[model samples]
Target: MSRRTVLVTGATGTTGSRVLAGLRQRGVAVRPASRRGAPAFDWGDQDTWVDALVDIDTLYVVPPIEDSPTGVPRGMGDISGFCKYAVKQGVDRFVLLSARSGRAGNPEVVAVEDVVKALGVEWTILRPSAFHQNFAENFQLNSANPLRQSIVDGSLEAMDLGSPIDFIDAADIADVAVETLVGTGHHGQTYELSGPRAFPFAEAVRIIARTLDRPIQYTEFQPTAWFERLRATGVDETVIGLVEHVLHSHDSGVFAGEFDTVERLLQRPPRSFEAYVRETAALGVWDMNQAANKAMQHQR
Candidate 1:
């Protein structure tokens, strides 16, 4: 029997990296496809696609989002074309990392989902909620890099979204993705993965403050103010727009939905916000002094 090789796109990203580790730990043959990874792949560069698809029967795709020069959110461009090419390459299975809100609110995600489903292959879609890692990794709070600065000093802005969000951990998303990729009975299924419970951003900040033993404040921000703050920090305009869109959707009560999909798939309750905060705090993810020093040095 020939060994099955799986290609993981966005291989170094939050969820993709975790998926790669999980696959490797399970003794699965895996190929990481990224602009920097071997057999490099770029969503905008079609020439790099074919080489990365070689000898790969399964694919784990996380669509790349890049900023547009026009300051608009650029969705995955031409995913249908890529799906067609992948089908021609004999790829038999696909797992797409989509968002719970995107299924209804974002046309680009809907189009990508449609393309993957039409491929006539085993496909599983993961629609996950806001990731808990955003606070420590993507969002401008407690980031380790000097180039990024916190949008708010010592205070975090919470969207007045009118409801609580069930932010899932990236690791839990990875676990479920691994199972869907390598295990049985998950084909043609769409799983909405979320944390065990929903809570407002103020509550989340309180949990983080308690876990980290620090004084962190959460202030409710209107959508316009949030957009301006992100823009002032030199964030990509497209990303800022997307953030505003999601915040508006949340305010409209779109992202408050929760599910037991994670528990059912992994046979364990998904990691909670408190647990994520505790683990991250242990790793010094919320160290204000370190972050302040880095920012100060960068300014010099």
Candidate 2:
């Protein structure tokens, strides 16, 4: 039998990076693809697709959100076309990374899944909640993230709209992605993954504060102010729209729930928010110097 050749898009991203590591650990042959990787793949550039898809049996898709000048996202620019090309290349299986917002009728998520399903191939969809890594990596540390400003300015303002979010760990998402990519019994299934429990943003920050033994104050950002803050931080409209949708979901209590999909799929309880906080805190990433170092490491 031929060995499995899995192509992972967004290979250096939060879950994609973890997925790559997990696949390698399992001794699976993985071809990492990004806009600037060895097997370079760009959604807007069809010329790069062939190289990324060659000899690949399965794809672990992390959909790109490339924004156009008009605040519209050209995700996978033409996912349908890409899927057809992959089919032609003998690729028959796909595992897509979607968000919990998909259930709330997120247009981009819906469109991507629709394309994957229409491909007439084995497909699995993972709708994961907000990633716990968001706090330590993207939200607090990543240069592009507006919330990173809070880390510098000592103003940890976020939406405190009373609803609790079940933030799943990216590692858990990667594990499930690996299983669906390599294992069986998950094709044509859509799994809604989440952490074991849900907690409000304030409580989550408090946990981090306690873990770091520092005074990280959480300020409430009303809807308008939140949008304004994002704009002021130079966040583009595409991301702003998505962020607004997510904020609406949370404020209306859509995110105040948990799912057992992680446990059901992985046969183990997902890691808790407090545990994630403690572990990340131990890494000294909350410190500005450490955060800079971590950001540099991620960019590499």
Candidate 3:
């Protein structure tokens, strides 16, 4: 029998990129599928899907995100349709990346999970908490995002809501994804992965501030002001709405729970927020000079 080839969609994204690295370190054969990747797979283009799935035995699906409040990107092919096609093409197993927020009864998430289950194949769904990397890798450090200016200026703006979020490291999620992809006994399971503990966003910034030994001021915006701040930053309405909803949910204490799924699966405790802050600080992403340099580069 040939070695099983796994196709990983969104291979450049936070968790997807880590998943790719984890699989590679394990010597697993991986085919990365992205719009710009070698196989050139795109969710908006069905013609690109076949080549990405060819001879693949398993899949790691990172569903396409929406730019609209509807959670459906205009002109993107249906993911359920893609799953059906994959099953037809002899892909036997699937690991889907979803969010814990979806557990709150989001219709789009419900539909995706339903289709994956109906595929009649081995499947596992991972519903993880917010990623720890978001602080370092996403809008925080990316100079293209207007939010980076605040970080560079040593001001952290947020709609705190006093939520105790259980943020998981993307690497941990990747570890779990690799295990499920290469091992057995995880099929048909839905794992809720989170950090070892939960804390408010302000506390997380405090950890960072302490690590850097600099006063990184944390400012909480009221709902109206928060919405306006995002708009001033050129954030689209859909994302703004989603952020508002998530923050309100956080205020309602929807994501205050911590899960042991990471430790149980990896036989190691989840990495702490302090660890993330310390390690990320060493990278100088939060350094004023480094962040400003990145911002300048994006401007050019």
Candidate 4:
């Protein structure tokens, strides 16, 4: 078989970046596509699609979640246009990065999945729960790193959804994505990827505190309170909306379920939250002294 050149959209993003790295590590030919990358690709600009699709036999798609000018979260309106275009250009296999909620018929995600399936190509959909890296990367609390505002001022609070969440590691998601993309027997499969167990947000805080040997408290906030808190910090409304959506979904028990798909597909147990925390701690990512020094510097 000729070398497979897989086009990975959203190549620079969290999960997409991991997927790209995994593909590269496996020695598969990959074309990383982003708005600014060479052979650039943009969801809103149809004209840029063909170049990104050129000579590609496999595709890894991460649909863009855009922010409306008014601050609401918006989905890729209709990916069918791009899906049909890719089919005509000769791409044969597809792996879509969708959310766990999408399996329950989230309209936007369903629209994209529908298009891929209707295109008559081999396809696999990965629906993963919230990523564990959200704490270290997006939320910023997992870091013993000083809160943008001093923790003394109560400026930083962990939003509790009043439920347990199955937080999967991004690396695990990438592993499954690679397998589905290059391996067989996954066609027409919609796997709900998650960590081995579900734990409440409070438990996550405790884990960080124990692993880092720091005092970290978990605070429960109503959706409205959390929204106002983020706004007060000058967080973008679009990002706040996305956060609210996920937290609210958690509150509603949307992410409370665990899945064995990760283990089943990878043929090994999914990495646990504790393992992630232990490894991260070893990296000194949660050093309290370092965070405090950074905070003090910012204050000065």
Candidate 5:
């Protein structure tokens, strides 16, 4: 196979970075299109978009972060106008990173999907579950609070930090995205990729605590307290609204199930949660919390 070239937007981000690596592992030529990467690209700015996309047959499009938390590509504006422009620019295959919003036919994503469909190109949609990186990278979970066992159930079956709720790695998403691009069997279809297990938040916290030998815990926030606390974190109002929205999602039972799309499709079990935390910690993410965080993060 003459290795196909791909332009990956958000190439430096958690999942996009991995996706880029995944492409390389498969012997495909990859042009990393991020402000930080070689052919650095930006989403909203038009100048960068065209050139990075030039000569590329496939794209892994992760819309720039919207003020909202759903990770919806267009409703907040960045991608709404870009989709039509992308197909019009002569790109053939598109794999957009979308969230579980508005189902498979969200007006915004569908609008872009419609554009690609009309352009007579092969397109795939990847709707991934919450990332395992969110734990080690979430910032909120790293507190060295006077630690409590109440937040985690050690006896409950648990996996590593990479486990829980089927959190798929970003690179895995990219690998699959690229596969759909070079191959034709997946055109016009959407996939929901998740980690291998359906775990409670408590189990996730417990495992992290045990692995690091830290006393961290998952404290169930009283609704009002939770909102007030997050609000105090200087998170913007829109983001605060999104957090509440997620809590509501959990309350409504929207996030309480497991699906097997990742391992089923890739034929490899996703990395376990504990392995995720341990590795990141060894690399110094969790293992290097500042002395200030020890007091400040736990103070609240």
Candidate 6:
């Protein structure tokens, strides 16, 4: 009997990489399919997807970039095309990495899922909230673009997020993905993962300070006050608009469901915001004080 091979699309990302790592730790055969990675499956590039899907029993679909709300650079209608082709081939077991807010069973992911289901493939869907890795990898950090932010109460209500988001660590999400691949229990269910507890941004920042021993703070900023401060810092108009959009959304109560799905999935509670802040801080992932620190140094 041949060993089952699991193909992971988007192999380089936060969730995908963790999936790969988790699978490897459990001794499952994982073929990473990404443009520059081992199996060479580019979501936009059809030939690559077909090549990688050969003899593959399971797939972790992270979706092509264009489907993302932040707007990816991929071409139009990428999702439909990928599913059509995957079904033609005999690939089975598709696990999708869908957004917490967008996963309202959108025509997008749902459409592909439907196709896979029609093909009689086993499926599991994971809708996870905003990742903690965002603080380190995304454009939101203080070091990359220096800014003095007084924004506080970063508490996002979770229902607007399309569901309660316990904000599961990418690593935990990966563990579940690998478990589904290796173990049999999660085949027909959809799992929503989040951290054990949800705290507002101010409290989250305080945890960062406690963990890193840095005096970092989270200050609340109204739109007007935020605009003025960003203007003084000479923040670009484009960047300012995006920040405003996020703030407006959060403040308006779009994300109301925040707290504890990670523990539910992993049987162990997810890491806390403080652990993320502290761990990242100790690792120089971001100097919580680095941004304002730079602003202060330059002002003197």
Instruction: Give the winner by TM-score.
Output: 3
CA lDDT of 182 in candidate 6?
Answer: 62
The positional error of residue 297 in candidate 6, measured at the CA in angstroms, is: 18
For candidate 6, give the lDDT of residue 59.
Answer: 77
lDDT tens string, model 4, 1-300? 235789998787777888899989999999998988998888778889878988898999887664432122145454667777888899989898888666545555566777777779899988888788766653321334333232323234765577898999999999999888878888899899999999887787778777767676556667788678768978898676556555566667778778899888889999999999889778764565676787799999
lDDT of 4 at 35: 84
Model 1 Cα lDDT, one tens digit per residue, 52-139: 9889898998876544422122454556677778989999999999877664466556667877899999999998988888777752
Candidate 4: Cα lDDT at 57: 89
Better candidate by TM-score, 2 or 3: 3
Error of 3 at 289 (Å): 1.8
Tell me how many residue pairs clash in candidate 1: 0
Model 2 misplaced regions, further than 4 Å: 1-3, 66-73, 139-153, 228-244, 288-300
Which pairs of residues clash in candidate 3, taking residues 3 or more apart in a chain or in different chains? none
Question: How do the candidates rank by lDDT, highest first?
Answer: 3, 2, 1, 4, 5, 6
lDDT of 4 at 170: 92
lDDT by residue (tens digit), candidate 6, 32-57: 88778756777667778767888777
List the pairs of residues colliding in candidate 4: none
Instruction: Name the weakest run of 10 consecutive residues (lDDT summed) in model 2.
Output: 65-74
Residue runs of model 1 more than 4 Å from their true location after superposition: 1-3, 68-75, 139-153, 226-245, 293-300
Lowest summed lDDT across 10 adjacent residues in model 6 is found at 151-160
Q: List the candidates ranked by TM-score, beginning with the highest.
A: 3, 2, 1, 4, 5, 6
The lDDT of each candidate is 0.77, 0.79, 0.80, 0.76, 0.62, 0.60
Cα error, residue 114 of model 2, in Å, equals: 0.9
Q: Tell how far residue 34 is off in model 6, in angstroms.
A: 1.1
Give the best candidate by lDDT.
Answer: 3
The alpha-carbon deviation from the true structure for residue 84 of candidate 5, after best TM-score superposition, in angstroms, is: 1.7
Candidate 4 runs further than 4 Å off: 1-3, 68-75, 138-156, 227-248, 292-300
Global local distance difference test of model 3 = 0.80
The TM-score, computed over Cα atoms with residue i paired to residue i, of candidate 2 is 0.86
